[model samples]
Target: MPQSPPTISPTFRLATQIEAILYLKGQPLSLDAIADCAGCDRETAEDALIELMDDYAHRDSALEVVEMPSGYSLQLRSSFQNLIQNLVPAELGTGALRTLAAIALKNPLLQTELIELRGSSAYQQVQELVELGLVRKRRQAEGRSFWLEVTEKFHQYFEVDELSLILAQSPKHNGTAAITEEE
Candidate 1:
């Protein structure tokens, strides 16, 4: 017998929306991307996004589904960005910042790769970035390669969509953090 693909259930639709809101924020997302992640059809993913958009609109949320050069991203309504900026103190320092830039640029790269490029200190840098919620680590196959990627917070700090700048700024991942004055 030919195997059939699993269908998207009502519960699955809701879950997919939640994951979309969490992962796709400040980024473009294609229906196919969402469908791939949700393990459902593109039509189903589109339907779920439409439904989620309506739900947010009805609630008059501080966030919204926005179309960007990349695709669809859940972004903070312009009115709220300033308010958020005020909460994060300027004294946080740059160890986290440099680390953030490195991960944002070489995303999905292994921790060891980062360390090798930047040296042993890179581990401490990654640790600090992870602590600040600016970066995340995922264990991959082949002896737990740590996958490094940026968090939503990283997006808000630079006010940019593409992460290419970080790479151009620092190709070798040096664990040494940079110190900068308040902007």
Candidate 2:
């Protein structure tokens, strides 16, 4: 008899399907979006995402399924990003860069609060940032967790006394973080 493809569980198959969608999109995607693209229901998409998360968590793979502020994504594992460091530009990825920008915009931000805002994945970003000398992490004296601030190196690296000025001028920012620059 023609060998029937080893009957993969439906959930596993769905997760694999969603993985492909995430890979092709090259960005975070909501469960609903994944459902629509995969022609599956939202619940199934969510379950698939969960399954994918577990699959990646267990497999010895260099990629991961991470839930971002926007949605779920399949991307390079942060731990592996540095392995291929010599091949890529010596710069943080977009997600980490965004996290750094957020810290700069809100300097002296509490690490807990930053994680709450950016999600747990930010922990890795903060670590990378501290290693890069762009951010400083120090434990709070009180019972609270660590506090994060932009290092002096941040200003020199970005070449600005105030990053807010640069962000405010960006039309995409909608001027929400805008602060008046003294003439």
lDDT, candidates in the order shown: 0.65, 0.81
Tens digit of lDDT per residue, candidate 1, span 1-183?
Answer: 955434545554554554554464435777776666566777877777878778777876888776677777777788888976578533344755665655665566688777766678778878877776667788876786788888776677667666555534665633223311110
TM-score of 1: 0.41
Candidate 1 lDDT at 120 equals 82
> Taking the candidates one at a time, how many backbone clashes does each contain?
3, 0
Model 2's TM-score against the true structure = 0.44
Candidate 2, residues 1-183: lDDT per residue as tens digits?
A: 754323435564888878888998988998888888787789988987898899899999999999998988898899887776555435679999989977887777899878888899999999999998889999899967998999988887777987666677787664434422210
C-alpha lDDT of candidate 1 relative to the true structure: 0.65
Over 4 Å off, model 1? 1-12, 15-21, 24-26, 89-96, 99-183
**Candidate number achieving the greatest TM-score relative to the actual structure:** 2
Model 2 ranges off by over 4 Å:
1-89, 164-183
Candidate 2 accuracy as lDDT: 0.81
Total backbone collisions, model 1: 3
